[model samples]
Target: MCSNLQKAMIDLIEVFHSYSGKEGDKYKLSKEELKTLLQNELSGLMAESKDPAVVDKIMTDLDENQDGEVDFQEFVVLVAAVVVACHTFFEDLDKGNVTPCSRS
Candidate 1:
């Protein structure tokens, strides 16, 4: 049986592949693919951003190789960062530094 962590890793790879290879470079995510992935899979994150150029900014930051596309390594960096951010948010919430109802 796959452990929960293993399953999560598989899901991450699967999700990346599902959104990649549609336009160019079967192993990398094009800007459009990244945009679609963000809109569909990370809608909450996307919605939380007020900047209209958020996608562009993310692309610039994530394309570490200046390749104009996000490969699995770069993609993993983004996922890790988000996971850490969520962990921090929850830690803050637990410490009463963040109110859960602040959004509502």
Candidate 2:
């Protein structure tokens, strides 16, 4: 059986491919694809954001090459960032520096 971390890596790749190539390049995520992925797969995370420009902001940030689309490398950067953020949150919670309800 695959290890938990291995499974997570596989799942992440699958999720990215599942959203990419719907509108354009088969290997990259256009703005719409990224938006759809966030709304559908990450609804809880996206829901907490009240910014109307969040998607645009994310797209701009992730498109590191400024090619107008997010390729797999760029996509991984976003995933890493999120993972780091979650790690930090849990670390803070464990240290009693944060509360579950106050993680804003």
Candidate 3:
């Protein structure tokens, strides 16, 4: 069996492809695909998705090349960022620095 970390890496690749290639660029994620991926996969982590501009902002920020799409490398950046944020959130909660139930 693969190690837990290997499984996580595979899962990330699967999740990325699962949302990409609907319209164009089979290897990249368009804006709509990115939004769907976030809404579907990160719904709980991204409660602010209610804001329509959230996706727009994400796309703009992740599209470092300004090509209007996110390639695998770019997608990895987003995943890493989210993972880091989650780590920080949990770490803070553990130290009593953040309250999960607190309103943002």
Candidate 4:
């Protein structure tokens, strides 16, 4: 059985791959491809202020080896960061600290 973290990482990778019509294939996303995917697929999930720069920053931070691309492991770390940020945002909302609104 995989650990929780391992499972979450796999799930994130599957999501990334599924969007590319290449699920369960041996593939690693180049920087530009990953940026496009994140912008198109994750924009709704992220803040309205999210743009290419935001994605680039994320890629830079997560691409630990400075490879200018993200492997599955790097993508997993990126997903985890987003998950944590979202959780914190929701927790703040639940505390009556902030109101949530749709960007559109």
| lDDT on C-alpha atoms for all candidate structures | 0.95, 0.94, 0.90, 0.71
- What is the Cα root-mean-square deviation between model 4 and the actual structure? 4.5
Clashes of 4: 0
Highest TM-score: give the candidate number.
1
Once fitted onto the true fold, the runs of candidate 2 whose alpha carbons sit more than 4 angstroms away are 102-104
Each model's backbone clash number = 0, 0, 0, 0
- After superposition, the stretches of candidate 4 with alpha carbons farther than 4 Å from their true spots are 1-11, 19-26, 45-47, 50-52
Across 1-104, the per-residue lDDT of candidate 4 in tens digits comes to: 99998997677667777654333334666766776777677867645763648767777887798866677777778777778998999999899897888534
Instruction: Please report the candidate that would top lDDT against the real structure.
Output: 1
Better of 1 and 3 by lDDT: 1
Clashing pairs in 2: none
lDDT of 1 by residue, 1-104 (tens): 99999999999999999999999999999999999999999998898899999999999999999999999999999999999999999999999998875466
